[model samples]
Target: MNPVLGQVPVYNAYGSVPALPLGWVENYTPTGQPYWFNTITNQSSWVYPMMTSKKIPGTNWLFVLTHDGYEFYYDRDSKTSVWEQPEELKEAMQELKKLEEEEKLKKEEEEKQKALEEEEEAKKALEEEEENKKRVLEEEKEQARQEVKRIKLDQAVDNAEDVEATEMTEEDIMWQLQQMAEEEVGMDREEEEEVQEEAQKEEEIKQVEKKPELSEQECIEKFYQLLKENNISPFAVYSVELPKLMLDPRFSLVPHNKQKNLFNKYCHELGEQIKKEKSQNTKKPENEFKELLESKVTTKMYWDDFRRKFKNDPRFKALSVTREKEALFKEHIRNNLNKKNPIEDYKNLLRHVKEIQKGIRWRDAKKLLEKYDVYHAIEDKDKREDLFRDYLDEL
Candidate 1:
């Protein structure tokens, strides 16, 4: 009797494993047994012989071969190694072979089941995709059919008239069309001329009324009211304990942008300032300034009173250019001088002395500049004075 397998250590099967893994070894030895190999040092050392095996189909034995060494004997009848083999290995070997075969069969069945499931899923998915494609195509065909029907219906319209048999001459029809176009163009042109003429009249009226000078005290009061509405706080009293209020962010007279809103906030701030001043004045004995300032916004009497309040005051002192010969000579002097860079009171007295020396009346010089656009024409100071002096002398 010959035995191909032994009750050997598990390490004896490592030669059957293929190659190295990156960081792990293949651990395919049977459980609960260990094996050892002899090192390259001794000649009489016995080793678990390396063998390769395959089934000779429909036989009770498996064929065996050594791993390139010729020490082992081959037995063709039993299909096992004959040398250095034991009798106790037959049952263990048979059990191991049966377990391996059962595992392989189970794995093959699992793979076949997995493949069948995958194929079933793929078939169901394909069927669903085909159904969706059919539905989309059906909807597209239905929409195209409806569109074609609508076009045909429009072409074969209801309440349409039949063609007339009478022939139309091209020359007469063209003449009629030309006459109609001329009449329409003429009507449009006349309407356009009328609109333009009306617009021109309105523009002329606006142009004539465009005087930069302050027209009335009502306008002046409105200007002050507008400033107060924009929340422009006046300068405060130099106090110690009170929180200093900042000027409102809204009071640029000639602002870079947003003049309208700034004007509105300016009025609001000034109104608040007036209210504060009024509250302080309520404690004082009868004051006329607060009363006049608190007067009605619509009152013309307030303007007259305001005019009277400043009348004959030194603030309105007959300035350097005061000449009484012209009716608005005082106003003329006030108008021509830039309000921002006003002449000092002492400087006005000197200019008055110089004007008296020129022998041309001072009022006449102020009037000449105020009435006409003299600023554009006048370049030379000396020449202007000479011409102005001549005009005043003639006056």
Candidate 2:
């Protein structure tokens, strides 16, 4: 009935066929043409098989060829086929792309959150470090205060011990007399009278042992001595130094108001002494600086000009501080060059200018004076013109 059936294997029925490739079976249509059947996909086609369909790796798609020799992709779960790729595979890829974007966004958010947390932690750690330093400084100050208190307490205890020892000696003598009187209760009255005379002489000796009170001047001198012994600076402020001074045993000897007055008086005298000493110490160098300025600098020269001219000199280098050297230069200018009279110095400068003859107009004289450094020394144009007029009047 069919010529192709003679070329293919003959079977009594489709179930009676021998084993074949996976998901594939050789069969014939009712018209007796050769075709293929997929036992797994349950689909039939009429084309000579080259190979069975295979699943694409990691996907629900299969690489398929039709029995008519057309190639495409197939999705068995959706039972859909396409010439290039199945719609289900495209949808799955879209879902995967969305998931990847979401994952990337989630990762970035995690990194940002982690950075914020680290920044906050760093700020907290810095605050803690500063707090610890402050705590340590406070502890050190407290320890110093306590040490000063301990020294004053030790001195007070020594003075108290001396007074207590004298009182204890007197009490022992009285106790011995009492014991003797009780034991000699039947003895004569002359013995008791002799003991009373001895006790009266002891009372006179105790009165002589008492120390005299110090005068106000003596108390003030003692406070100064204490300050010197402690090496306190005369420039130290009274309020700041009061706490340390109060720890001294001599501090309480004077009345509070008197102590304050005495402290002010002592500091004033001591500060003057220190100032005089410093002035004496620095006088030589100051004189040297003044001499350098007189020799090398002039009123015509500015500070920068002087620096450029004498920067290499030993005297200039010796005055190391910029402000101090500038101060000395100004003082030298005031004393020597300007003679504490800048207007007169300018007038003299104008008189010296050969071009500035008497009765010359201020405008013409200013042009001539401008050629000299002294003209530029007076910064105000109006002042220079006024000084020029004054010099003309003198002429």
Error of 2 at 67 (Å): 96
Candidate 1 global lDDT: 0.45
Any runs in candidate 2 off by more than 4 Å, and if so which? 1-209, 234-253, 260-276, 283-288, 295-307, 317-365, 371-395
Deviation (Å) of 129 in candidate 1: 5.1
Give the number of the best model, judged by TM-score: 2
Clashing pairs in 2: none
Provide the lowest-lDDT 10-residue window in model 1.
Answer: 237-246
lDDT of 1 by residue, 1-395 (tens): 23455542222322365332122222323773434333332122223333456553344445454444423333455444444444554565677579779989999678556645654566587679968976796687567656755764565344122435566589857875686577567756765786688669868977875645544554445545544454334432212101111122222123323333344555567678789989986643222322323442121122334346654543333332323212232233344433322323223333443444445464665554433222313434565555555544644
